[model samples]
Target: MTDVVQNGQAKRVSNSAIFAGCAVFVAGMVGAAYASVPLYRLFCQVTGYNGTTQRVEQYSEKILDRTIQVTFDANISSGLNWEFKPARMVNPKIGETIQIEYTATNRSPRPTTGSAVFNVTPMEAGAYFNKVECFCFTEQTLQPGETVKMPVVFYVDPEIAKADETRNIKTITLSYTFYPSEPGKPVAALPEGNKAVDKKL
Candidate 1:
């Protein structure tokens, strides 16, 4: 009787351990799946500052009377291997549409595909800005030694020009960086916006 009871207790302990392990595994899988989308988005935003989501705005324009023309600049960081350029630096007037063009070449021997994300920090009135052409949202693939010209079309809102906070604004900077694509992932594509005759480079 004692032997049988002992064996039964041992079997119950083993079964409990197995059940707990299975539950933990299932919970982990569920948590991972639930967090995947948000995690991916966070990664993209941090890596490139894609400017898809709106950020908190803090505008100050105490120098409205100063001689300053709102200018836009570009910055390319390290770790991303490519050549880049800007089509325009200073937009003449509010609501004026301008194109910023850049050429990217794959420096590595292997075919490369990745997304270019950007951030625009304009003077106080920059929030009224609208982008008509943007490659930042789409993933681009380049064969070795191949180069492609990318364009971003944007206009500053007229309201910004009239705003008290932006009256003295002189420049806005748009910066971008690229990152490697995950293996076996489908290329992410974004629809192109309003078309303009871009100077073929």
Candidate 2:
């Protein structure tokens, strides 16, 4: 009887250990699923995969005479009540930095915050498009009936003219879509001393 009881106790302990191991495995999988999105985004940004452009502090001083036409597109998702558009189309020489403004107006009666997701096309051109400064880098908040002008600084890498796939590409379109931020996330506050312009569209 003593031997039988000892065996039973050992079996119970083994079972508990197995159950704990399974629980830990499941928890790890859940954590990995949550982390995958940001990890993939980081990977794309670094490799310029999927038309994701690279962010740069500055470009080379040499400007190639090859020019490319850049078109801008702005969109607001279903829940965001705002009017957005690019100021104009621009054509710039490769490696020459250019700045442009986008205007957005909040039509809602209450403060609204938005974050933008952007991409460049055609896909091959993404690896060559570099942005120095862009509004898409941060979340934007607009007060009721407020209108704001945002700027983007960018350049086409001169190396693009050497890439056989994109060398002859004449135009690239940069598109941005604004969406409501996730719930409970902190909304970025507007810069101090900048009064909201109550210009409703």
lDDT of 2 by residue, 87-152 (tens): 588999999999888899899999988877888899788888998777777777888988888787
User: Per-residue CA lDDT of candidate 1, range 104-178, in tens?
Assistant: 777778777766555556423435555655666556667787777787666655555576866656666666666
Best prediction by TM-score: 2
User: What are the per-model C-alpha RMSD values against the true structure?
Assistant: 7.5, 4.7
Q: Estimate every model's Cα lDDT from 0 to 1.
A: 0.57, 0.81
Compute the lDDT of residue 148 as modeled in candidate 2: 86
Residue-level error in angstroms, candidate 2, position 127: 1.4
Task: Tell me the RMSD of model 1 versus the true structure.
Answer: 7.5
Could you tell me which residue pairs clash in candidate 1?
69-170, 70-170, 70-171, 71-170, 71-171, 71-172
